[model samples]
Target: MKMTEVSFDIETVPSTIRYYLKNATFYDSSCSDNAKTVFVKGADGAFLKISKKGSLEREYRMSNFLSTHKVAPKVFAYESDLENDYLLSEAVSGEDGTSELYIENPNKLASVFGEYLSMLHSLPTEGCPYKNRTAEELNELTNKEASLNILTEINYSAIDDVIIHGDYCLPNIIMDNFSFKGFIDLGYGGIGDRHYDIYWGIWTLNYNLKTDNYKDIFLDAYGRSKIDRDGLTYFTQLIKLCD
Candidate 1:
């Protein structure tokens, strides 16, 4: 058996892929363009994710946290060097929501997305280490084009904190026949306002489906009788500013 090879985004390519390529498979693309992920189905199955060394710790921490709650993949091992990092974890056992099957069933997909998000947001946050505070978030904003005044101008109502999946998009969600499986790309997850995830969920649906016809369906499924239009606008602006 010969090892298979695949081109990854130029950041961190895995040397182990060459050794295991005969029995392993390579994923050239993922939701994140910044990192590289390769899937290997061995004794139990796993993903070998490679990325820059510094920030991979967050994903490792977050994955461990969620896995404890039975909400994410189980981490197998994590290792790193000065220039690159590696994360090996059990492969999520479901079809990605971005798959054509799910894409065709927008109503079912959106409903499941909303229900799973509700479950996620309901998790306890007392000891959770990650937080997406507004002040901290604003301070991290790097977009010179957006006004800093926008932050000051927005009057935030009392916040309700829950475990927010930072990048709650279609690709990150996994489903098996409309039943929720698990979440991937958890680097951005933390305790944050529900609106942040809501905004991204809506944005992702619109983006991936190439239409804005289903925001209400998702919101309804998420069971928000009182929509926080102001929070939505504010956080959307905040994310845009940061970008």
Candidate 2:
């Protein structure tokens, strides 16, 4: 990963499926892009972030705001594509949350992320009008019968009211040896319920960490009741199956 540069490589099955060059350029609808992209290229490298215009605007706001709140890549400029509209930005350096942290020393893992999530949750929820990703909203989003039954069985409001990553999975979080560098993909991040984030953390530590003790260690550190385990588990699945 290169810093203070506009070029970036996209990661995919083939290692690098594509790349973008960003150079303080704004959106342009006349370009050969239907998918809006923010392109920049500097001495280090180049990168392109592809997204719809609305999503690009939202991501730009998030990238700016989140950088101040936590760790996020900086934005040089953004513009609409010639054929489509996609957003782009400079890439930040660091590993995602799906690091060895989840596969090793779960107590340490939970303790580390537990503190971060707690810190985010402890913030005052004022002036933020975003709603939590509740099971209700999830149901409305998807109507597949197989998925609906699974969602209906679980109660999403049991342990609600925390700043959920919205997509609190391993990949969204970035870390380096128990050290949290920052978070990415804040598409769903907002002042929602803490349980949303905690549930994923708890589940990941327990299942991926493959430790029976993780459930207790996480609950103790997270300062929540184990009684909400069922809800957390159900909601975690619901979050995973979300479109």
Candidate 3:
């Protein structure tokens, strides 16, 4: 959410997206350790993300898929060579959920956040390309330093499959005028467990607002009938271990 004005050599950008960056001012908008995101400021704004080669393939695919549902920005180009991957996408127009405007109204923000997440989960997933998220997380846990008994306590079968935002947090959910715009940072997104997204939704509210008072409000807006409180707790702990 903190974007600092900075300079970047456009020559380093992949030729496929270089045209978009020419003569544009650059801002260091990166938040993740895995990628560097430059916000290109101009009449036609865009975001240029750079990472190791092959690292952004899943993101590219998922972004394009989400665009079809009008819940994400359109991907302009995805190109990679032997050394690095580059993704250029049109910027979604809005301030993210972490903006002071939204933070000032915790009640409305929590309700809108939950409503949008429920809408995302309700999207049909007939042809989703990424469906092995649960398996992948379980695989990750296998290499973790957890005790065997603790690992056995995780009930993988209890997870409900739904298209998840993967890293669903306040900063990733964009909004304008208190209305939902779209989501960003979708590299881990795909058809996965809904609890993963739910867990982060709750976590982000607490992390950003510095309070847990909105948890019940969020769950209620998201429809508590669809939630399993015990499963949410279990998956939350399981995901923390994987992280």
Candidate 4:
């Protein structure tokens, strides 16, 4: 996506982050409606995300946790007031997975994507602060006003929990010259079922490439032997309900 240069008054920013805004150009890089993200262009590049108060606490914690594993950006400061929260973090190196250079070659991109996802899932979750996201998500789904009967038919007794990138779509995964760099937007990340990531891996490829051709290539690279078809189907439906 193109980041359009925009005018911003730095005086309105949180005092804790005003030091990073000196003589920096502002770009409107926001992709979500829930928050406003400004890209600070200066000698020391950074991103300033502003949102409702308390909305970013989990993201701040998750980013710090993943940064320790060398897979995410380091947070500079997180300041909150009665009205809003401001998060400042260093900009990660590399273009996101949706870059044209990578999307031009779907096969290679799919393989690299699968390999990196497998690597992420292999990381130990012993110290992870967020746990059992699968159960939490199910609770949310069950509480939804809409009636979803499929939730009753699926048995979640057997689940292979792992550290999952909750939103594993193309825009969230960063790549540097076809090599894995890091992941962004970690608000939903935590200890969850692997199928959550796998389902998104397949969905993103289809959505970005506008075809359903690369699903098997990605599944194969991630090892189909480790995947449970029933689990994948269940999570796919679960996500649809939540959406």
lDDT of 1 by residue, 1-243 (tens): 112446434234455433343455455444356786776655556777778886678888888899888999998777787787888788877787788888898888888888888889888886666875555566676454356677557776526488888899988887888888898889888888888888899999899788888887889888786457788888888888778
Q: How far is candidate 3 from the true structure (C-alpha RMSD, Å)?
A: 1.8
Per-residue alpha-carbon lDDT of candidate 4 for residues 161-205, written as tens digits (9 for 90 to 100): 688888999999888888787888888899989999999999999
Q: Which pairs clash (backbone N, Cα, C closer than 3 Å) in model 3? A: none
* 2 versus 4: better lDDT goes to: 4
Q: Give me the runs in candidate 1 sitting further than 4 Å from their true place.
A: 1-31, 142-146, 158-160
lDDT of 3 by residue, 1-243 (tens): 789999899887778788888889999999889899999998788999999999999999999999899999899999997899999988888899989999999999999999999999999887777987777777776756563346567564545478999989999988897778888888999998888889999999999999999998999999999887667866777786776
Off by over 4 Å in 4: 144-149, 155-160
lDDT on C-alpha atoms for all candidate structures: 0.76, 0.56, 0.87, 0.87
lDDT of 2 by residue, 1-243 (tens): 212323333332021213333233333322225342333434543245565445556556555566666555665555554332344445555555555645656567767667666666665444334545574446564757787687668765544455456656556666777677666556666656566777677666666666657666666776775336667676577667774
What's the TM-score of every candidate structure?
Answer: 0.85, 0.61, 0.93, 0.94
TM-score of 3: 0.93
